[model samples]
Target: MQGTLNEIDIRSILQLIELGQRTGELFVEAHSGLTNTALAESNRSLLSSGGFGYPSPAPQPDERFWLVFAIDGRIVYAADRSNNNLLRLRDYLRFYQVESALDSTQVPLPSANPLEYACLWGLMENRILTPARARNIIKNTIEETLFDLFNLPQGTFNFEMGPALAPHLTSLEISPLTAKIVKQVQQWKQFYPLIQSPNQCPVVTDRDRLQQILPETTLANLESWADGKTSLRQFSRYFNRELLAVSGAIYPYIQQGWIQMSDGCDGMPTAASEADPFGIAPLLVPSEQEPHQRAPQVVCLDDDTTIGKTVEYMLVPKGYRASALCDPIEALSQLFREPPDLILCDLAMPNLDGYEICAMLRNSKTFRGTPIIILTGKEGFIDRVRARQVGATDYLTKPFGEEELLMLVEKYIGLPEIAPPPVLPSE
Candidate 1:
C-alpha cells in the first residue's frame, strides 16, 4: 500500500498492517514543499483506490527516508536511510562493551540491507554477542527508530510484500511498542522551546551553583557529560537510558539557569570515546623541543560583516584559525594564494553568488577535494540540487547557531586540539 501521510497518519497505517497480519517492507519518505492542495488530491486518489497501490517513484539522493521490515505484522527491523553508516550501530555496540569486536572484524560487502544489520549478524555468527544480547540490541534500536518516526509531521509510505530480513534476531508487536513511544513523544513535547532537539548539547553554565546544590559525585558526572560537545541523544546511548529520562533529568537545571543548550553535530565522538576503559593517552604531546602544531584553518565569505564576524567569533574560541571575508572577489584571490582547510561561502552576493564561487573552486585541482559548504536561507530542493551539482560538499541554512557552524566545520576538517584554558590571577 502507498499513500501520503495527509491521507493516513503513521499510527493508523501501522494498525492496518497489524490487523491484516501483513508481512512486507514499508518505505517512508519525508519530502519538503508539499502544498495543501496537492495533499488533498493525494488523499482523494488514495480513497478512490481503496488505499492500496503501487509504490511512488524512487526518492532523490538528498531526500530523507526510512525503512521498516516486518514479518507477520510484527516489526523485525527499522532504520533511517541516512543512518546507514555504522555510527549508530557502533554506538549501541559500545554501550554493550563489545565495540572493539567491530574494529577487528571485516565488514561484509554491502547488500540489500543496511551495513549495520549485516554487521550485527556477523557479530552473532562469531559469538561476540549472545542471541539474547543481540535481541535486546535489536529491540532498543527499533524503539529508537519508532520514537523518531512517531514524531514525523508528514511523509509518504509504501508497503510491498517480500521476504523478511535475513537472520532476524526478534520481531516485536506493533501496538505495545507504538503505545510506549507515543507516551514518550508526548512527554518530549513538554520540553519544547526550552529543549528544541536531542541534538542540542547541554553545557553547564553555572558550575558554582550546581556544586552547591548537587552531590559531589553528581556534580562531577554532570561536568564530565556536559562538556559542551555531546548532545542529549549521545547521553542516552552512553547511559543506556531513554531520551526522555536523560532530558528530563536536565530540564529543571536548564530552567534554573545552571545549564544552557547549544546545537550539536552528529560528527562528534561517540560516548565510547569518553568511556574508554584503558584511559589511552594522546599520540603526541607538545614539548619545548618540538614546535606546536597549527590549528585547522576556516574561511567564511559573506557580504554582511555581522555574519562574517559571527562565524569568526564562534570558531576562534574552539581553537580553530578562522578568517571572515566581506569581499568575495578579494576573498577568491586570497583563497587561491593560501587555501583554507574549509570554505563557507554565502549564497547571495553582489558580484559572485555561492554557486559561481563553488564551481570556480571545483575547477581548480587545489580546491577540488577541499570542503566547500554553501550557506543560504533557501530550503528548496532545486537549490540543494544545484549546490550539489556545483560540487558543494554540504549546505547550511542562514542564521545558524554556533554549534551548527562548529558541527559542519568539524565534520569536514575535524576538531582541532583544544588548548588548555588560561589560568586566572589570584585575588
Candidate 2:
C-alpha cells in the first residue's frame, strides 16, 4: 500500500501494519520543499503554548530517504538511505575499539540491504561484538531513525509485502517504540532555535567561562567532546546515550552563548582522520637534499573515467597533485579524509549528483572555505543559479580545455608554483 503522508501519517500507517500483522519493508521518501512556513502552520499550537521557539528558517535534513524492515509487524531494522556508507557503522565500531576488524574482513557491497547492516552481522560472526551488544546497537539505530521519521512533516510511503531482512539480531514492537520516540521528539522541539539539529556540532566558544564555572573533570570532558568537529548525534553514539540526553546536556551551554553550534555534514572529516582506513596518502616530493614544499592537491570527481583522467592529466603536469575518482562514494570518503586545496566535481552522476555533494561539503566546516567548481555539460542560467545556491565557487561547462580548467583553478588556489632547479657547482 502507498500514499502520501498528509493523508495518513506514519503512526497510523504503522498501526495498520501492526493490526494486520504484515511483514515487509516500508520505504519512505521525504518530500522536498517542506518550508518553515508549513512547519510553523503545523505546530502553531505548540508555538502559541511557548513549548519551543522555532527558527524562522530551520535547517532541513539532507537525508531525504529512509527504509524500515519489518517481520510480523515488528521492526527488524531501519536506516537512513543517505547514510549507507560504512562510515556510520565505523563510528559505532569505534566505541568498542574494534573498527580495525573491518579492514581484515571483506564487507559485502550494499545491494538490498545497507552495507552498515551487513557489517553488523559480520561483526557478530567474527565475535567482535556480542549478541547482546549487537542487539542493543540495532535498537539504538532504530530509535535514532524513528526519531527523524517522527519529525518528518510530509513524505511518500509504500509498504511492500516480502520476506524480512536476513540474519536479524532483534525485533521491536512499533507502538512502544513510537510512544517513547514521540515524547523525545516533543522534548527535542523545546530547543528549536537554540539547537536546530542533532547533526549540529557544538563548539565551546567561551572556554574561559567554562573553566571558571565547571569543575576540572567536567571541564576536561567538555573540552574533549566539544572540539567543534563531532556532532551531538555522534556524541550519542560515542557515549551510548539517547539523542535527547546528549542534546539536553549541551543545550544550556548553547543558551548561555558559551557554546556555539555549527551545521554538520555526515561522512565529513572528523577529529579522527588518522583512523580513516581508506585515506589517500599525499604524494611525496622527490628531492632529499633540497626539500620541496608539498604541491597543491586537487580532487576531481566524475562518473566518466575519461573526465576524471582528463582533469588529472591537465592538472598534474602543472606541478599540482591531482586525484581523479570515478566512484562518488569512494570520492566522498577520500574527500573527508583529506580535503584538497580545491574540488572539481561533475554535476551529473548516478546515486549522488554534484549539487547534493556540494551542499554536503558546504555544511561542514572543513570544506566551507574550499573552492568547489561545478563541472557540467549544462550551460543554462538556472543550472548556474542552483549551483550557486549550493555554494559552488564557480561553474565550468563540459568540453572545457586545459586552459579553462587551469584558469579556474588559478583563480581559486592560484597557479601552482614550480620551484627552479638548484644550480650545480662546477668542479
lDDT of each: 0.73, 0.72
Compare the candidates by lDDT and give the number of the best one: 1
For model 2, residues 281-320, the per-residue Cα lDDT tens digits are 2222212222233556899999998888888777777767
Tens digits of lDDT, candidate 1, 180-204: 8899999999998889888798888
Angstrom error at residue 285, model 1: 40
| Number of the predicted model whose TM-score against the real structure is largest | 1
**What overall lDDT, based on C-alpha atoms, would model 2 receive against the true structure?**
0.72
lDDT of 1: 0.73
User: Where does the lowest 10-residue lDDT sum fall in candidate 1?
Assistant: 277-286
